[model samples]
Target chain A: MTANTPPKALAFDVFGTVVDWRTSIAALVGQVLSAVGRPDIDAFAFTDDWRMRYLIGMRDFGQTGRGFVKLDILHREMLDALLVDMQLDLAEADRHTLVMGWHRLEPWPDSVEGLNRLKRRFPLVTCSNGHIALLVNMARHAGLPWDAILGAEVAQAYKPAPAAYQRTAQALDIAPGELCLVAAHHGDLFAARAAGLQTAFIHRPLEYGGAPAPDLQFQQPWDYEAGSLTELAERMGC
Target chain B: MTANTPPKALAFDVFGTVVDWRTSIAALVGQVLSAVGRPDIDAFAFTDDWRMRYLIGMRDFGQTGRGFVKLDILHREMLDALLVDMQLDLAEADRHTLVMGWHRLEPWPDSVEGLNRLKRRFPLVTCSNGHIALLVNMARHAGLPWDAILGAEVAQAYKPAPAAYQRTAQALDIAPGELCLVAAHHGDLFAARAAGLQTAFIHRPLEYGGAPAPDLQFQQPWDYEAGSLTELAERMGC
Candidate 1:
């Protein structure tokens, strides 16, 4: 298929695009802090620190020969480090609760209904950094209707690496151009475009929660751009 | 934790367990034969030949040093060789139609509703030899509500190989015994059990059409046995 063959499938970037990870994660941290008798800790700052480690971990691990670690493992690893760095003490069960809380994330209000609309027209699969088990549990918990959960673990590489995008397209048996990457971050779409995938920008302004989301602004010439997933459904004629 | 924990997810075997490929492929072969003015071809025998080659292909491809190949490509490859062996001259379009027909398979009458019921109780996934694309298309075509599609392509090994079942359990973040494999074939269930998975035997009496399915007899010690997908749901308390 040529570059203009209307994408046969929509590969989604799940973390911040489809779900309110910042708010959900902050809530988890806040709960843990309160339970541990240290409620004064800034939950958003802790979440941001953990997310920063996660991003850096994915970048370094994907580029190295570390050979595919699941995002759940990385998340727990980051959680452990942050606990030490922040000088917090907790029982093993609470620590486990904090790390596994990712599986209980809530969807952005418009994500589910809009995705339901989009699914009527396109096969919806995740091309997220989250591994299959995490995505499956999140889908079950958040009522996200993913046709398939695929990405980093299956591709053996994380996003922003060309293999991550190219391999996802290959998995769906479609030309890169025939599989559109629907992602919130500009860096993700840039890498997808570089890998010859069509790009659709879905704005998730509150992804960072009270911090400037520099990537949330519309980048020029994306195949489609919408403020909410519901708007994306309207734009896609779903 | 232990061998007795209830399964966290249900991984299904698609081919003869969820859909009647013998009947479906025979119908496709009959159409192609009629379209080529060779209606005398025994479509059932032809389908059996194609299936035999397919089974051999998967067995060899999975165990060999040959890198991962998607089932779609393998299906097309087998279709090409079968046409040559049968001395049939089908146009490229007709050849494509026959191979791609696997994506459009008709589910057994009980599959959709029963799977829907099961999905409410467990995260449903496919552990078929079919690749993600094939399973995604088949689910869309047949209304199979799979939360994830994973198998040969993702695991890089086919069923009866230890890696297939072991890797699926790992991908789900569950112990091998925590993933119940629901399949019709004893070889598949036996391998799964060997890999420490719980097994649910599904009886597809008409899978072989007019031929006897020797493995259809009750093999003792399966975790559960049911006559149909609906019955499996009932037995699983879905």
Candidate 2:
């Protein structure tokens, strides 16, 4: 690409796209539930429940106009509810540690290498539902190099909401069309595209907590599609 | 520090600490004035003048109920005013490139390596007055590997305001005492310390446009004081 054709920036969806949130959360839930002698707790279901709460929290924040609530706070709130629903109670210390699972998500195999390659040419950022601290710690833990972290918390709105993508584009000083959202989830890509951001759909295939059904189907037209970040990086000529 | 000793995330004050704004702005001014056929214009004074307008912009944003404005937009406004005051006429394209100097700041000589070392152990983030886009572009251009970008822009409040530091600490899900503000400027460190954040003074004696000045001094007790981020990294056992 010519110099003027170079992308000004690349923003990522962190949870499943950059970091393997499902596997990470599943592993943590398995270890914890096993330790508590509740080995049959359906770790995947519990993980899904926790994430569902995060989504509900964002929707509530939007409806109530309570301003932005960081992911950590929302995670803690959701974790408490999840524990109650699961009929598990733990000490405050244990609860705090469990709530921190969001900070220790594992990166997908190609995330670091792909982001590093992309960063050689374009600024790379995270536009996740995760709060700033959680994303920062996750980067430190996973060794993912990000130029900056943007989130629904920054916009006081979450994905599927136009403001989330718009706020990120605004923060990057790029027109919505100039910056592309690289995500594994079709819903996220659709939302980003709807907000006028170009979209790159990378197939994660196993994002839905490893459910039997495949998760890698494109729902709409996106600017790019790749099998993985590695493919995306190669296609970007990085 | 023991593992139980909570990690103290290092939040940096970006503008003059990580970026050599004076040099960057001086160079931009020299280029703009030269292009306009006045090679001997006081670019240094012009830089300071433009910076004064930036400060006014911040104050106005803070005093009014207006949200935080991105540094680029604020800079453009101030740049226009500065050009009018200097009685210079310039093409919009040239003015655009000149304002983009903020995106091309040079990292201090020891910055990248120092930050790299710190990144090996501690989370390194930007706690800047610069807008998120400005900081992100500066980091990308200067090879500053920030784990995340935190700013008054996110909090809608400027530095020295308690909300700026507190919002950062909250975002990180770390207590104020568990986060440290590292900077060459005493005011930033003082504000951080006052807001209950640990402080670290990194001496950048030449931050103010290379003019001769009094020896840099530290007024408050910081958790650590070091000459550079490399030294700070070593101190933190990175």
Candidate 3:
């Protein structure tokens, strides 16, 4: 598909694509660490470690068909294990607050404005691994103006699993070909394309903080590509 | 609960509560009838009959735990059966246009404004039997800004079924008591209350055209009652 004829709907990958989760999580952790007199800890490294654990958990879930667990539960469990590994002591309330940092992440500079522009033309939804409540709270906090929330919890399966993409298209009553999966991650785009969805790649060069960026170039042919969501919206004439 | 202590979230029954389905369906059927040269048919009565069949279908589905079907498919099936009973002869494309009348229903005069006000105070969503796609399309068409769409499609069960209400609250990660099910129908409110949800009743006296309205009076003591959506929002200080 060309820019002139965009897909009927756009489903976004939320955590790193729409919201700058790494920066937000590091900031939140820094504040919490300072409050607990543990500011010596590297908050950015902690955030990256937490995210790596989440990916491992999702991979394990995908490997084993163990019944679906909501992302919040998984995050809390990961936080508990991480704190134990780091020999950190924190109150239950503080731990809960830190785990909920996912809900308060800040959006990318152009995410809200570009989403609003794209929404006027195509129905916009989140097809992330986040649970519905997490997605709803994030959208409310970031003013992301999504038409519907569809993701792992709604599909009872996480990303890279065919069920997640298939269920989202089914829920929208649209064929997979009519939907576009927009993400900053090549893996997500590749999986969505394999599921028969059109794919758009938005470059997020700083998604990993000081760490080396993933391949921002389109590894293979995709439906669309842009430097940012705002450009994507402009390309689609939104 | 008092007006000072509102529920964490408000879940609305969409069909007759938020949208004036009776008037909208009658208007659509009237247009279809004229197009088919069958203007003599009583559009209002036809709509009533169609709705009655929908109720019976829901009841049957609830009795037998047959796997979930999207509301659109059920509506189309019912339309086919109704057309046959009415001895209507219309092309398949025209029949489809008439069946899609559900998708184009107009909202009640106060729905958009009242929901906007209430949304400021609480996360508002729909808990009707309508599928996710149906609710999303209707909200976009009528300008009803829903934070999330949760209903039969997500729960895989129709309303009055315990799972539907339970799943919606669970999806929002709120206790049933922290969720208010607002509806114009007493039966819906009763079922929601039975499932441990707070209930709010908004009067929609003209929900049924010439047919007598369902008991407009609250069948039992509900958490809240109002003459209209605007009144409900005001009572809640939204």
Residue B219, candidate 1: alpha-carbon lDDT: 61
- In candidate 3, stretches whose alpha carbon ends up further than 4 angstroms from where it belongs are A1-5, A214-218, B1-5, B215-218
- Give TM-scores for every candidate, taking all chains together and pairing residue i with residue i: 0.94, 0.88, 0.96
RMSD (CA, Å), each prediction: 2.7, 3.8, 1.9
Models sorted by DockQ, best on top: 1, 3, 2
lDDT tens digits by residue: candidate 2, A1-238: 1133445788899888888888898888888888878898898888887876765666456676666666677788889988888778877876777788889999889888888888887888888887887887788788887888886878777876899998888888889888888988777887787898888888787777456323235376567878788889998989
The candidates, ranked best first by lDDT, are: 3, 1, 2
Each candidate's fnat: 0.93, 1.00, 0.62
What overall lDDT goes with each candidate model? 0.86, 0.80, 0.87
Structural similarity of chain A in candidate 2, as TM-score: 0.90
Better of 1 and 3 by lDDT: 3
- Looking at model 2 chain B, which ten-residue stretch has the lowest summed lDDT? B212-221
Q: Is candidate 2 or candidate 3 better by TM-score?
A: 3
Candidate 3 C-alpha error for residue A99, in Å: 0.7
lDDT of 1 by residue, B132-202 (tens): 88899999999999988977788988877889988998999889889999998887888898999899888
lDDT of 3 at B203: 80
